[model samples]
Target: MWRSKARQWLLRIPTPKCSPLQYQVPPGTLIASRMPSNRPLPTFTCLQNPRLLSASPSFNSRDLDDSDVGIVGNAVNADDSRESEASPVNLDGEMDESGSFGEKGQVLQEFGDSSLGFDDDKVMSEAADVDSLSSLWEESVSADDSSGVFGSQEASDGVVDEIHEVDDEQVESVLSLLQSTLVEPLEASLNKMELSLSEDFAVRVIETPSISGENLVGFFKWAWRNCRSVRTARVVELLVLAVSDVPELGKREGYMLWDLVKEIGAEKGIVKTEILNQLISMFWKMGKAKAGLEVFDKFADFGCVPNSDSYYYTIEALGKRSMFDTAWTVCEKMISSGRLPDREKIGRIIAFFCKGKKGKEAHSMYSAAKEKEICPQRSWLDSLVCSLTKNDETVSLAFELLDDYAKGSLKYANKSFADVVKGLCRIGDVKEAKKLVLRMVESGPPPGNAVFNFVITALSKGGEMEDAIALMKVMEGRGLRPDVYTYTVVMSGYAKGGMMDEACKIFSEARKRHSKLSPATYHVLTRGYCKMEEFEKATDCLKEMKKDGVQPNTDEYNKMIQSLCLKALDWRTAEQLLEETKESGVPLKGITRSLIAAVKELEVEIQSAENNIEA
Candidate 1:
């Protein structure tokens, strides 16, 4: 009856299925039968059939854990050797039909005695080992279940990296939504886009067409309230661009804006160099260049270091608007700070210095640049050389710099030689220029056609047409062909000398060589005819300009209308020209002013003649 009960338990249990790594046991089933080391194995003295001790069908390597097998291997039976061997169960909890009970008892006894040693110390050590292994297996299974629910660690990280990358199109779309002028709509658009902007980029995007000053200030306050980090430079720049056009951004407004920016900068501990430079750029763009200079002066009080770009832009802005004295002060400041302006900026500085008639100071700057191994641009060097040659005292020094430059860098020899010729001719010293030309020709490398054109232009302006015409012939004798600039210069010279026929001949020659002539070339001929009071020829010039697809600018139209007005032509013709000027989208202010003044003067003369006749 005991054998039947054990056999029935084994049959009732389900079979274990094989998996990739191990066999799986049924849920809620105890995979191993535990018998404590302190307790003895159960004795079945009445059970005679050894097959009843066979393992359940559900029992497999995975169903019985390693610890259960270890305990079974340590179990010893005290039955007779033949009877123990006849038992079917093996130490691995598997049924072994070939082993008799006697052999099983012998194997079990040997396993328990030799391997387990069955002492208290040995059992305790084995128990600790089993506990550690069990904990490790549980942890591994928990990790696998988590991974199955989600994904592998590497795959999840890749998805997160992709989500963080910024898209330019998305940024533009967000900016587009903020085009509404109303605060409520703007807030709604921002929420709809679900976007956040860095405060600097946000300020840049405030240039939407419908955004007003009030809207901007509200948005700024909102950003501040929300603790957004805005760049001081970008905020100042945006305010200057957007608000300066509305009304005078008065001292009170400027102070408020600056205080806000400064307070933020102080809180963040940011470097204020860039912010100050931006303020200067803003003032210059708004035509408040003197104010920009004052802003630069405040840099020291704010503990900001003004960089080379700061001084460079200030000087350039002042110089462009003819504020030379202030520009010089800023340049001096830059030099004192021991920071050299970059190559492009240095060109502007040298040009400004030359404009102030301080050729010596400009040359000194160029020398310093050279000493520092900063190569000046070809255009800047040419301008400096020309300016130096214009003055009697610096001409020799200019040549010395050029000679030194030529020795060090051989690439600019032709350009240097041409500029020198042009400068000497400009100053009405063609005799020295002629000598230089002869030397350039006799030498292995000849001067360009630009030098010959410069000489011809000088002679024609000085009333030496015969000499000018002779030089043009000699220029063609050389292998070099004249470019459009060469032709334009000669035409300008002839026109200025009242030699319209000669000027037209040069214009036709240029047209023959190159099918297209510049608008400047056409203007030269028109002005020459106008000066000669040949209205028909001048009118023909305008028609030709139109046929050539060259739209005359405001100045060109002014010249033509002035000629017509001075000739006392019909007001109807002037009216027609005014209409054309309007249709062409050129500004009508100057043209209309000239026409109105000319008509009023003609009316006054007509009334005076009528009064004389009546008397």
Candidate 2:
């Protein structure tokens, strides 16, 4: 190891004899010979054999090359000498005129009367072993790469490294200031750090941990003001993220930070779409929907074209506050621009419009996103369809959406299709309602009892008994039992037709299937029998309802009593029903009770008139 290090050390030294010999170096004479530079400079010293300098003046300069000279790597300025030492060059050992060297000092003593000097302690220790000297040499160079104080190249490198360390420390200082300084007037704090600002420095400060968004905003404004170059595109983006990243940032603070971003963008002309988008997203997270909208509106001012995220976040913000009108407007813009957010975000937009009852606009967004191949998830589509089916005008749109999403088992679609069927039925589009039921039965998501009941009820109300029965059969074929409401609808249709037999057939089937039927079935028959003036059958229905454990509603009693009073004028039986109705705790209508009283009075008047005539 010692041999290898000694060789490496020997190779590092250059000229030894020509070294400007200084017997005594001043306090800092070894600092630098020339301006510090990066070029590899060989160090020179006169510490080697001092006897080499004793060559006579008559010796040719070329002869000095043949003579032995030691190696030291550096150039020493000859003119920098302070004290000259006695000549240590021994001519007998060196050379004379024949074997002589002229210009023994070469360039070092080029001007006449210049002296070579060596004064350092290391020189006097020339008698020291190569190993000891080698150790000392290593200690000095290893101690500091630039400590070869007379070596300008190493000094230059040292200066560069020092500069980098200082820069790093200043950046840390700025970051410390950023985290602690919350209020305004950040420039003073930054100035105290004496930061040598750069994009990297600004980025480091912005990225510092535990830094509040407010402090970051302050720091950002400072950077923009004091060092505009630090606000590069990357720096600005990081600034936005740093400002937006704080979870506790309130709406007011969020707006202030956003305003700072805007001001910087406006003046610096460095506004970017993503930068603005970060602010919008921050507002969205903060629930500051209005502020997000303002940022969205100024997209043009920032020289940024709104992207898909821009629209999505803006719509989401507005929707958060139930600002559907403005949200829809932005959604329309997104549609017109043909830029839709990702599938998930598109789903959220649909939900927003749905929440606002803007089902039509929601559908439009859904369709446009579909056109762009950005369809929302199935659940979202289902929600959109549900919303569409709510309004009479948009039921078909919901119906259309149903077909697109009806791909899988259609089981998930059952709820949505149920709503669509209801809307279809409510709008009196009984034909379409029937088709939807059949479609469900044939394709997928076989209609449940509710969907079937809706269509059946609509058909029965339209007096289409056959269609209503047909739907009930289809429903049974699918193994879904018709609820009591379903059977009631079929019977009502038949009773309306005065086909008592058919109505009774449906009633019996409902009784067998349901163990207990709704009172609506009995009412249907009572109405039908009364229409035929067969009060006996109507009274039997009342008896059957009581036997069957289905409580009769007031409507049946009202109709039966009115039939006896008005149609049959048989107020005697009607009075019995009134007493029965009263005993049963059912409140009879005032008009029906009055009719019975009127009938009683008429009977008395008739008797008196007849008696008077006979007398």
lDDT of each: 0.62, 0.71
Per residue, candidate 2 scores C-alpha lDDT tens digits across 440-528 of 88886877889889999999889998888887888888888898888888888888878889889888888888877777778888888
The prediction achieving the highest lDDT against the true structure is 2
lDDT of 1 by residue, 354-391 (tens): 87887887887787678778877767667787788778
Residue 72 shift from truth in candidate 2, angstroms: 31
- Model 1: which ten-residue window has the lowest total lDDT? 43-52
